[model samples]
Target: MQFYVGWSHSDALFSDYYSDCPTLVSAVSDNQGTLKRFKNKPNKLIIDCGSVFYVKQQKRPTLKHVFEIQRSLIDECPNTSSIRLVHFDEPMFNKTSLSDQYYAMERTLYNAYEYLKVVSEEKLPVNVSTMGVIQGFDRASVHYSANELKKMGYRFFGIGSLLAKNQKQQIEFIKYAIEAVGAENLHVFGVTGITQMAEMVRMRVASFDSTRPTMAAAYYQVFYSNPFRTYVISASRAKPQSDRLGEPLYCECPVCKENPQDMFIPSPRPYMRLRSIHNYYHLVKTIEKMKVGTEREEVV
Candidate 1:
């Protein structure tokens, strides 16, 4: 399984530091210039239409406009071997009524069809594959959404708006999607939980993305792998949500090797970035361990 780290324009140097990192960037957040900053590095990238950014707006950009933005970002990464372009989808987060949820699902299907049509007409390169976004509220809706996208010739599919759901619901919806489309090319969006990550691996998901490392670092929390524990930075004024750790653990990551103390300093944004890098390293290690354990079980 591939893990794409959610990226931001402020962390443009991330690719330079972690050359092997697979990254996901939002078209609404990062522009072509931001992508160009890491063009020399050949890492896998996912360019997603920032539907969540426009979810609250009464008016959203046209499909053509958003597709153009995604295309422009794709152009900046000629060296990137793999690029997944996700269609704009109407998120189902705030929709409570059945009618509202139905409308969101319909809008998402419409966008998927139109996006595929545009991709065909534009003749996007083979390396640039389009992912159909699946938006639904229940098992039946989820199956219907996935089936429609499959009918539209979407080999790569992603399910989103799951951030609002509980873990059991999230896993159920994911299973529904896999049942409809299979797990070979299915991607789960915005997954952060360790248990969920392990479940995705067990179920053989193609990929998932998260910004948890950076988000945790910004909140003055640090991560350590192996046993997979989190701690609050000792110097941080933020109330300890987890155990407080004054010193960094033994890590071979560039940030830790250079100056482990940088992670403990919570003031400057650069320090936070360093902490995020360290946290990301541990998260990646945790995923790798999970993968290895899963593989060994299968072999046994």
Candidate 2:
């Protein structure tokens, strides 16, 4: 399974630190200038329309406008080996009404179809591919959405609008999508939890993306691997808890090796960035361990 670290403008300088990192950038948040910094880096990139950002907006950008943004970002990454472009998806986050949920799913499917049509007309590069965004509220709806995307000739699919759901619901919806469209080439958007990561590995998901490391750092939380764990930074203004750490753990990550004390500073944005980089290192290590364990189980 491929893990794509969510990238932002602030992460531009450190983006190249992890040579093997696959990145996911949102068109709604990142611009061509921000991506230009990655022009020389040969990382795999996923550019999504950032539907969740516009979910509450009364007016969203036109398909053509959004497509142009995505295209421009892709152009900025000339050295990237592979780029996946995701269509604008109407996220079904707070839509409690069944009708509202259905409308969101239908709108998502419509966008997928139109996006693929434009991609075909534009004749995007061989390395560039479109990912159909799957949106639904239940098992039946989820399967229907996946089937429609498959029928529209989407070889790669991603399931979204799962952030609001519980773990059980999230796994069930993912399973529903897999049942309709096999797990091969299927990516789950906005994954954060360790248990969920393990489940995805078990399911053999093609890929998933998350900004957990950055978010955790912003919230003064730190991550350690071996057996994945989180701790609140001891220097944070927030009340100290049992898991609070006064100093950084012994990590082999480049950032930690260079300045482990920097992670505990918790003030300057650059320090937070270093902490995020360190946290990301641990998360990737955890995923690697999970993958290795899964492979061993298969062999057994």
Candidate 3:
């Protein structure tokens, strides 16, 4: 299973672990500015250069621009294997023209798939995954778009925008689309709760990204201050991983069990210090537990 950790803006915004850790990293980009910034990072990282669609809803640019961006990254970092092209679709109500929105979406999706299929045939390795995303606020529309893309030779699928709120619905939709499209790999955008992880894993969805462990580490330091209030705030961000009454327990991770309350500090700001030395120990340990099966004796 390929674990895709998505960085919302730039890969630079994430901690050093993203650049150094072997876990796969996916980054979003709409323009060349961020592409120039991140296409050079070393590590066993695989980038998912997001959305080829423009926001203005005008005449789409010639397909040459999409190829150029892909070509630029390939030239700079030949090791980058997977390229997940996202498609940001506008809501039906907001669109300037309603003339065949479905047809237009299908055309763009086909064009993007055809562009990558051509590249794969010539220069890229046959195994290099060119994943496509379905962008829509509604689950049904997203599923429909994903199915259409699959018909155009896309095997992997991505879901965006709708995930931040209706994660459960996203999971259900992806499950149906996976069966419909015969998708081997599915990625859910912008969510990584413990419960959500269990569900995704069961559904055999390839990967999902989240800053939950990092956020949990930050919550640990503040929990002791006003345990109830801190738990309330942190719970809103991500569900608790363990049962420890608001202490932000990390029982599944060995480092947390060993270090306990010293895992993080709150002197400065909570978010900035989330990746501090102590927090990293637990964070890495948590990741290891998630990746490698932890023995009872080790975690206990």
Candidate maximizing lDDT: 1
lDDT of 1 at 247: 88
Question: lDDT per model, in order?
Answer: 0.85, 0.84, 0.47
Error of 3 at 192 (Å): 3.8
The digit string of per-residue lDDT tens for model 2 on 44-103 reads: 889998787767678988888888888888777764469999999988887889899899
Runs of candidate 2 exceeding 4 Å displacement: 12-14, 39-42, 240-242, 294-300
Estimate the overall C-alpha local distance difference test score of candidate 2.
0.84
Which candidate should be chosen as best, given TM-score against the real structure? 1
lDDT of 1 by residue, 162-239 (tens): 998899889998998898888987999999888888889889999999998999999999988777889998899999
- The number of clashing residue pairs in each candidate reads 0, 0, 1
| Between candidates 1 and 3, the TM-score winner | 1
TM-score winner between 2 and 3, please give it: 2
Clashing pairs in 2: none
User: Each model's TM-score?
Assistant: 0.94, 0.94, 0.56
Query: What lDDT would candidate 3 get against the real structure?
Result: 0.47
- Candidate 3 lDDT by residue in tens digits, 100-155: 55655555566556666665555654324566666443446667777777677767
